[model samples]
Every structure is written in structure tokens, then in C-alpha cells.
Target: MRVDDFCDYDNSFPDEFYACLPRECPDCGAPMEMSEALTQLHCSNPKCPSKVVQRMVAMAADLGVKDLGEARATKLVSEFGLDNPLLLFSYEPDKDGVPEGMSFDVANGIVSQLNAKRRMTLAEYVKLAHLPFIQTSSQALFGGYDTLDEAYAALEEGGLGYVCRKLDISADSDVSVRAARVYETLKMFKSDLYQCIDFVEIIKMHSAEMVHLTAVCSDEVGFPFKTKADFYATVNNLYQNLHVEFLGALTRNCDYLVWAGADGSPARLTNKVKKARAYNEKYEEHKASGTLKEGEHEIKIVSAKQFLYILEQLVK
Candidate 1:
């Protein structure tokens, strides 16, 4: 009983339906992809009015710009014609175009607040990438990734391309496109952001266990492990890029002191080996004497392959 089945069907419905269909974005013209039902349409275009506000909210949080909510961002765009988030730093307010029932000075204060927070540390800025490559939901970005400078090198060396290809997200994909916009927005304020970043700071884990890797058993025939560097690299791999900082001298705060080969052929003891032996001797004495301090972890000593075996159980 539908009009499409009739012989003299009217084509007006098709034209009206096409005109009113919410299939594409109003601002950027990208197709609207809904989660479940087609009863509503949300813009995936990063530059679109709605999506821009969402990014602004996240960017504001990253920059520590308080009191600037999504509603305020939307109002600034829809009412005052201020669309780009970076424009807030230099937004000039006048007698008109302010939100309804809000004074121009109050609006100006909001802009001032955002401008005040334009500067953030390089660590804070890099964390805003929210890329698929790094785990975003934890402190792993700073603790697990290499030094900030080295991490930047990895990013420049096709890390981003790797993520895009792995996810099958072309450079033009919506989320990737939005990530590009976020990058540009930060770039616009790069000078200020860089001013606040401490170039010499190095991020590390909470308290890493240190060990010694001697070349004593490195070249021994029939040995499972190869060289000292190979041993160091294996332990470093377990930590996922955190340097082991092999104890070459006395360290006051060492958590572990693994002997390269406790049962190997006799070898000369350097200052580092002497320190490890002395520390463990004292540790064993204190433990037997029942004088071990509360909340203190005893230093451990194991062979090269034994250390690797212990780490193998923990790496995953």
C-alpha cells in the first residue's frame, strides 16, 4: 500500500526526504556514524562545531584551564563567533556578543584564565597525543617509554605511521584527522608551552631494582647467555626501555645486586663487585640478626641465567 508501488507515484517525498536526512554533518559534510540507532546524528568531523568543543574540553584539561566547560566553548562558538580554541588566548571581548546574562568582564576573565594556562611542561604536552601506540590510561607513558627526547625520536621514525597502518586508519580517518587538529592546536601555542618545559628533566619508574653485569661468564663456552651487553639488554627489555644502570660503583639505594656468575671460574673483583659482595654480606647479617629495618627489601644475588629465568617469569 506504499506510494513507491503505485504506477503514478509522486517523487516529491524522495526530494524532501533527501533534504531533511541527517546523514551528513551540517558543518563539515562528513557522514554521520551512529553508535546504534539512526534516530540521532553526531558529527565526526574534528573541526565541526560539536567535535571542536569536545577537543577543547580535553585540551583545556591538559592545559589546566579551569572553569572553561564544553557549554562555555559551545557558547563562545555559537554566540560570539569564536570557533578555534586557540583564539581564546587573544579573544577581545566587547559590549556585544557576550553570552546572555553574562557580563563582558566575566567572559574576558574566562579568556584570561585560559591564556594563563597556555603553558605546560613538555611531558604534559606529549601525553596529550593520546595515540594508539602508547598505553594512555596509565603512567606508562613516562615510566615505560624512553626519555622524552628519545621517545620523540621514535615518534619521528615512523611510529605514527605504524599505528595508523596497524589500526587500518588511513591518514584521513576521522580520529586521526582529529588527532592532527589537536597537534596543530598545541603547535600554535608551542612557544609558550616550550617555555614552561624543563629540557633536562628525565622521567623514570618509582624505584627500579639495580644489578651488576660482569663479563666473567660472557665468553665461556656452552654458556646460555652471551655478552654483558646481551645480559643488560635482556634485563632492560624486561623493564621495557628503562635503563638497568649496572652498579659500577657503590650505590647507597640499590634494590638488587645480582652476581654475573656466582659459580663461575674465579675472577678479579672490581670496586663494583666488592661493593655488591659487601652489601649482600651485611644484608645477610642484618637479616639473621633480626635487625632488618621495617618495609625494607633485602638485596638479592643470582647468576646471569638465573636472573634471566627470574625475569622471564615477570616480563609478561
Candidate 2:
């Protein structure tokens, strides 16, 4: 069976069963190569539209550029000739863009989204590179190391040593392999220096088993708005303030449900806070009943600002 098939019955594969087969990409009919280690293979042709689209998909997804789906990405290249992610965000005076059939406003809107995405945190950009084994969840994996001066430090501290130490698993284990891949990918990205992009977007993904965000800029102290006009913004800011994405909080699997609000008031609780409280309750129940595993996140709600202050003290 192929690597993708992945041991229908066994996790380990015998050496004799492995062999490269002559293959052609069904999408572009180009010759494809597969490493014994990799589960999936793609067309060898870099210009292949299908191959490009998936890369685009990875970039857009990591950058959080909404609505640039595979269908749209494919159309952007095959139909409109906008083949590059940078180009997707950019527009020329002559090209009436966006996959032929889409309206002018829609095309402009897509470009607008792309422009907005240009400004992002370094973690998000690294995630966008779509490097092998660097899943969104692994963003938190970097936090385990304490001495790395730069992200590239993961290649040193967070690589094998990190795996063996924090994970308490072999450095060569599959899980460690994933961490090692992140280190390798970061090195590869660093080779192409980026000067204009803001490195301040570089936010630390804190090491936690469980974390729940809570904050709502209500009528009280909420900035730039009156009467909770931006409740969602409050919840989002909590994530951003932590230098963690909304999804990153989940990935770190924070054990604490840090509640940030004006007096933990119900009226101030956004949907995120409410949901977190509910989830925390479930976690408590499961833990009490002994259904939760050792590594499973323990849930507790700490004061919001205080919660962050702790991170400030620890991370800084």
C-alpha cells in the first residue's frame, strides 16, 4: 500500500513492500515523484495550475484570506492568468480580473482582501509557507523552548532536543519528526529575506494545554465605539493581544479559561466567552469522572488582564 494508504492494519511498514511506481499526475498528466517518506505526491511541473492552486490554498488559508477557495484560486490562474498570491492581491490597470465570470466589484473585493492580508504576524506567514508537517496546530509546539532568540532557533533547541525533552518522546519519533519539519521549513523561509513585512506580527504561541479567551468591549471602557458596537472585536483582541490566533489558542490547548471582562459580567460576555465557559464546565465534569487523560487540558477561568499579565511575565 502507498504511504497515503498508511497501514490499513499496521502502523509500521516492511522494507520489502516499498517501491516507487511510475506515476503521472491525473490533473496535468505530468510525471510525478514520491519519496518513500511522503504519503502524497504532486505533479513535477511547477507551472501546473492544479499544483499551484493547492499551494495557493495553503498560503491563503494560513494568511486567513477568506473566500479565496480552491475553485477561485484555480480560476485566478487558469482563467484570469493571475498565477501568483502576490498578484492575486495586486491588480494591473488593464486586466479585468478574477476568473472571467466574477463581477467587477467581486474582483475588487478579492483584491481588497488580499491587500489586507499583506499585514500579518510572522507565525501566520510561516504557517502560510505550507511547509511539510507544519500544521496550524503545531504553531504552539514552538513555545516549548525557552532560549531560542529567533524562530530559526527552533531548528536547534526545539528540534531534536525539544522533542526529547518537552514531548518526553524520542527525538526521532513521528511527533518529533513533525517538530523537526517546522525547524527545517523555517530555515528554508529565512533564506529568502523579507524586509518590508512587519516582523512585529511575530507573536509567541504560549505553551499551554488549554486556554479559553474572554473579553468584550462593552459600553463601559470599550474603545472607539459606544454600546458594544464591536463585541466580536473584543473577543478577537484578546486573541491578538496574546499574539495568538483564535485557532492557536485552541491548538495550544490551554488548560485555563482566562476570562477577561468588566467584573466578569454576563452582559459583557461575548459569544466566545459564553462558549468557553460552557466548554470548561464539560472539561471539569470529564476530569472529575476520570474520563480525561493526563495530558488533557484542565479548565479554569482566571481573571482576564491577570491571565495575560502572567504570560507577559513568563514570555517577556
- The residue-by-residue lDDT of candidate 1 on 84-172, one tens digit each, is 44445455676355777556777777666554443322343444432222324213223345345543444445454534543345776
Q: In model 1, where do residues sit more than 4 Å from their true spots?
A: 1-21, 26-28, 35-41, 61-66, 79-87, 90-102, 126-153, 160-316
TM-score of predicted structure 1: 0.37
- TM-score for each predicted model, relative to the true structure: 0.37, 0.48
Question: Which ranges in model 2 have alpha carbons more than 4 Å from their true place?
Answer: 1-22, 26-30, 34-41, 44-49, 58-67, 78-103, 116-119, 141-149, 153-169, 174-176, 188-316
104-179, model 2: which lDDT tens digit per residue? 7766766665554454345445445454555553445444422234545555555557534643556756777665
lDDT, candidates in the order shown: 0.49, 0.49
RMSD, model 2, all Cα superposed? 10.6
Predicted structure 1: lDDT: 0.49
